[model samples]
Target: MKKALTFLGTMVLTLAIGVTIGQVSQADTPSAPGSADDPIVTKSYVDQKLAGVGSGGNTGGAPTGGSTTDASFKVVTLNPGQTLKGGEGAEFILRGGTATAIASTNGGVSDVTGADDLAQGANVELNHLLLTPRNDGRGLKVGSSTAYVLVRGSYTVQ
Candidate 1:
């Protein structure tokens, strides 16, 4: 009798858990412009993979990998002994921000040429760095002098 009772109790507990899970699943749901039935995981799950967006600023379970994360990228042509540089304190900024990187240049490093190189709409110039003092573009001070380029920044998309 005790064994039978134990079996019955275990069965009841399992049934209760199963029913709870079912209820919870039906309790709430998220939706996009449509209903939950037409779910659309329109968030970025791949970085540097290219498409309509970047990690989209949302991991969506995807983390940033490396320089070529969201999309395959080509490097700026550099001579054997050539080097590129940024201003003493030049930061990188993608027009419209990293989210818009898909339709535009996503994350950017200071030294390289404009965001997407010299492609159409490309605003950065990662090649041939000018090391003038006074922070000209994106490079160290050529020497210890004082000058300025005073140019606005831009991003590029391809």
Candidate 2:
């Protein structure tokens, strides 16, 4: 008799939980305008709701505003045994000429010749550097120094 009573109690609790879950899910569903039969689960409905959320700073989980500096590139040359120097926040590219030394906090050094020896076409961000060309090579040396030519590049300091 006790075993039969326990089984009956378990069955009743399971049925009650199932019914509660059904009612809660129905309550959470958004109803359609002028109609109770339709639940608003379409993508268009969700997008419309998000579109009206915010503006200027953060809207619908997206950053709506930012600041950027103008882009510019300067043409500078480095001579053999000469050194170019740059400080923190400086950015540049080796557009023309070769280098013996590309010393910076990022790029270690390249004491060679030709375009492949220089960091061409790509931006090189500097923390601090003292670039110098190899003595035997005909290319220029770039580093963070007042004596050498400055190959200042344009970038957004963000």
The lDDT for every candidate, in the order shown, is: 0.34, 0.44
- Candidate with maximal lDDT: 2
In the range 132-157, model 1's lDDT, one tens digit per residue, is: 22233332221122222222222121
Assess candidate 2 and give its lDDT.
0.44
Candidate 2, residues 4-78, lDDT tens digits: the string is 999999999999999999999999988776564664476678788777665343444433457433334354555
Off by over 4 Å in 1: 30-158
Cα displacement (angstroms), candidate 1, residue 128, comes to 86
TM-score for every candidate vs. truth?
Answer: 0.19, 0.26
* Highest-scoring model, TM-score: 2
